[model samples]
Target: MYDFTTFVQSIGNFLHGQFSPGVATALEWTLVILIYLALYAILGLVLVYVERRVCAFFQLRLGPNRVGWAGTAQTVADALKLLLKEPVTVNKADKLLFNLAPFIITLAALTVISLVPFAKGLQAFDINIGLLFIVAVSSLGVVGILLAGWSSNNKYALIGAMRSGAQIVSYELSVGLSLLTMVLLTGTLQLSAIIETQANGWWIFKGHVPAVIAFFLYLTASIAEINRGPFDLPEAESELTAGFHTEYSGLKFAFFFLAEFVNMFTVAAIATTVFLGGWMPFHIGDWAGFNAVMDFLPPIFWFFLKVSAVIFLMMWFKWTFPRLRIDQLLKLEWKYLMPLNLMNLVFTAILVYLGWHG
Candidate 1:
């Protein structure tokens, strides 16, 4: 396998040898930030195109097939329009937090993406407590949403914000618990170590029913957490107008919109790392030829393949299901997902203790 880490290390070494340590460090960090920014922007555009085309496929429509080869440039064009529009401020809005809110959510999305392990040496932040870090940082986006609503001084916006706050807070429990189930099997908080443990087989295959339950639990909670359809009470068009970001327009609105797709990607990437084996390719036992073929693809290829699969599943849920009432959404999480997740965790722990999970 190609060692991307070594290649990156070699670049860093060359930079250090060419300049003072502080300058080299600063330059390296600048390069990293640039790369992440490019990725963040590119993913936002690409994902928007993907979602449109995918939903169109489901609805039997043409989607974005006109602009720049199958509507590839459609999102870019829309982004430009939003950028060129005038940002209208609410007459009575709190200027400070209202302006700050978009950055808060956008920052949260960008920060969480840094923790994901894209390939063997592709991760930016490989912290010891990466899972905990992700949960904590990702939750911060709600605070921004709440602030956006309250600072806007709009009733509909406030309502949307409150709904989002409640939804994310409640569903986060299920997210943590579902990931914790696999933590027991892997016994590590590091993302890379978790992937390494799955080199033989993914937890979904090895941990049996409990792991499967946890995967679905995570999937369901994550959809709600990101405020997708079915659980998107915060921005339900029939009820709340534009929801938490109703007062936002122009670039501010674009920031909020971009953060959403980025957050979706972050959630899917985390799911890939935790439950779908991250960058590891699928391998059947005692099938060297088949395994070798799977291994022929790069780790990054496998990683994004799994992530794309998960993202498509999320989009399917959005297009297929009807939106849930707020009460029903909360009930589904607190009553069903939460309890089932707890039981699955207990069962997984028992299996791990008995050495029967394999």
Candidate 2:
């Protein structure tokens, strides 16, 4: 097996040997930042391409087939156009917050991804309260939306932002509770610990019905959290003319676009980590031969495979479901998901206490 941790340590040692300790540390930090920036840009372009191709197929039409072979360079070209376009300045907008909003959202997305365990020793930050940290940081995106809407001084933008605030606030409880149900089975908040506990089997298998229910609740709430279709009241183009970002243009608008894709990736990655088993290969009890065959593949491969499955599911919902009314969205969360989630949590807790859950 490839020792990823050792590889990272070797690079650090080489850097220290080439420079003073402080200089080496500074360089390491710079490299990490640059790597994450590159990752963010790459994910945005790749996800956009995947989304377009997937939706086109759903609609029985050809997607981006121009620019690069099979339309691979289409998103790249679009990104370049956004980079070169001049940002429109609103005469009466709050300059400080209007400009600052996108960075807040982009920062939240970047920061939360750091805590996810992509594979063993592949995580950037493995804090003890990783799960809690994710919940807190992910909630910050709504603040940016609110600021963007309010600062624009447009009623449509403000209404869109207000809807986003309510939607995120209501659905966030379901997301948190569903995750909490998993925490009961794992008995730890550390993301790495959660994956390690799943070595025997994933919670979705070991924890049984509650885990399955939690997984569904997580998906439903997460879809709403990221503002994907059916739950995308915040950016309803048909009604709000692009919603909270209506007043933004050029690079500013690009930031919001990038943030949405990044948020989608983050949501799916977290789901992969929590419910599906982060990078852990599947194994049936006492089946050494089968387990060994599964282990032949690398952990990173398993991690990405699970994440992609969850992403595809989200995309499927977006393309297939009709948009929900603001009232309907709230009612689904409060009246249905919340009550069911509470009962599921209690049931999971009993299972954990009785030693019925793995």
Candidate 2 lDDT score at position 191: 96
Candidate 1's residue-wise lDDT over 1-358, tens digit each? 9558998899899999999999999999999899999999999999999999999998999899888987899999999999999999999999999999999999999999999999998888899899989989999999889999999999999999999988998999999999999899889999999898898899888979988888889999988998885788888889999899999999999999999999999999989998899999899997999999999999999988999999999999999999998899889999999999999999989999998866
Error of 1 at 353 (Å): 1.0
**Model 1 TM-score on a 0 to 1 scale:** 0.98
Q: Which stretches of candidate 2 lie over 4 Å from their true place?
A: none
Q: Which candidate is the best by TM-score?
A: 1
Candidate 2 differs from the real structure by a C-alpha RMSD in angstroms, to one decimal, of 1.2
- State the weakest 10-residue window (summed lDDT) of model 1: 228-237
Model 2 clash tally? 0
Pairs with steric clashes in candidate 1: none
lDDT of 2 by residue, 162-225 (tens): 9999999999999999999999999999999998898888888888999999999999998999
Local distance difference test, each candidate: 0.92, 0.91
Judged by lDDT against the true structure, how good is candidate 2?
0.91
- TM-score attained by model 2: 0.97
